[model samples]
Target: MMDANVSDQRLRHQHQGLWLVAGIAGVLLLAAASIAIGAEDLSPGQAWDAVTAFDPADNRHLLVRHLRIPRALAALLVGAALGAAGVVMQALTRNPLADPGLLGVNAGAAAGIAIAIAFFGQAEAGAYVWFGLGGAALSGLAVYLLGGVRQGMNPVRVVLAGSALTVMFLALTHMVTINSEAEVFDQFRHWTVGSLEGRGFAALGAVALPIGAGLLIVAGLARRLDAVALGDDLARSLGSHPGRTWALAAFAVILLAGAATAAAGPITFLGLTAPHAARAIVGTAHRRLLPGAMLLSAGTMIVADMAGRMVARPGEVGVGIMIALIGGPFFIALVRGRRLGHS
Candidate 1:
């Protein structure tokens, strides 16, 4: 018996090590591809040199450093935040379909941006960050209230509440958009279709702290979340406080999801699918699952961005469009096949 247990532990450790190696390799490959493939392609050598050797006169190098690099980083950050948020959300709600977009968080951020443009005369995407964050926080609170979270909400109730809020916020956004001036609508229109283009270090800088803080909160709560995943009674028996875990999870979701939306304009379905993919690869352990999802998501975002550039040539499609094209089918398949209640 002792020998069998030892063998199992060794195999588990080996599997984890293999996943770690593969994850790092995947992120590196995606990052390199993102920097190299665009309107103007760069050879792998050139891309590596652009990062390693600085030259002010080389326009190719400048484009890599100033444009592609920032966009790649933004995609990485946004994907990571969304991926981590998705895992935490599914675990907390016990709903496989629970995601930032499905739960009304992204819609809330979009509504916030509309409000910022219409009421406050905010034009720059960076200027709307706080409003987006505020909206996400409020909408999350509203979902809990509507879902009767305190009354021990189940997965169906939670999703239903989220769906209701999503509709409400989206409707509000449309009304604000239609009533607003043409220019505001034009700006809002571009933002509503999520993209990683036109983002700079400034946008990244704005959301870094919030997203980082959220990740930390999730990490601290990960074990308790594992307990919670087994259900409330078992979690309490294991000395985990479900209420506190839920509150912290909510705050983390707002920070991560809001920051991603504010940075990337409410990209959909990455959160919905990333965690599922991660689970397939890394199983249910949050320690592996969170980072695994991040890498998978970041890689997917990079590939989507690269594909967008390829599919249209000089007239590139947006990353959001590419994600929707891919994720929409995935969503439909999931809905058609999966049982919709608690796991």
Candidate 2:
């Protein structure tokens, strides 16, 4: 029995290692493809040369360094953040359909941007990041407080509170937009769709610390999350502190989702679909699922961004719009196939 148990553990470890290797390889391949394929069309050799040398005097090198590199990094980070956050939320809530957006994080960020634009007249990318992060943190805290009633933070209550908060904040944002001038709407409209265009390394710099810290926290809490998944009472028996676990998970989600939302506007469905897909592929081990989900999310976003660039000819469909277009139907199908409430 001891030998068999050891063998089983070894097998699981091997399986997880395989998934990690595949995920990292996939991310590298997607990153290379993202840099090589774009509207301006640089050959693989040229792109490699441009990236390696990165000479400002050469237009190709300059564009690759200043534009494509930053945009690709942003997409990769945003995707990873969304993916990790999704996995954490699902584990925390034990709800298969839970997503950061479902908890009003995205809407809160949007409302923050709208308020910033309406009052402060600061539309800069750097400024938007701060506003978005503040909004996400505040909204997430509100949802947690409201959800943590009665016995504790019930998943259903959290979802309900998030849905209600999202609606309220969205309504407020709409009202503000409606009352404002066309110019303001025009500015907000672009942000609402979400894109990585015209953004610099500065945007990435602002989010690096928070995202790094969040991913580290998520990594440390992986075993705790796994324990929590065995049901609250069982997890408690196993020595897991459910409240502390939930609090850490919540903080990670806010850090990740907030940073992503601040960098790009509220991207949809990546969070929901990535973890679900990862689970389907690799089973429910949080250690495997978390990293797998992150890679898959990054790959999905890079592919979506590439498709968006190609589909519209000279014009591009921002990543946010593309995700909504793809994720909406996927989400509907998922909801129909599974009784999410019961699950």
Worst 10 residues of 2 by lDDT: 334-343
Candidate 2 lDDT, tens digit per residue, 193-250?
Answer: 9887766788888787788889999999999999987788988999998888888888
The candidate maximizing TM-score is 2
What stretches of model 1 exceed 4 Å from their correct place? 145-157, 329-343
Question: What is model 1's C-alpha RMSD?
Answer: 2.6
lDDT of each: 0.83, 0.84
Candidate 1 lDDT, 212-246, residue by residue in tens: 99989988988888998889899989998887888
Q: Show the lowest summed lDDT stretch of 10 residues, model 1.
A: 334-343
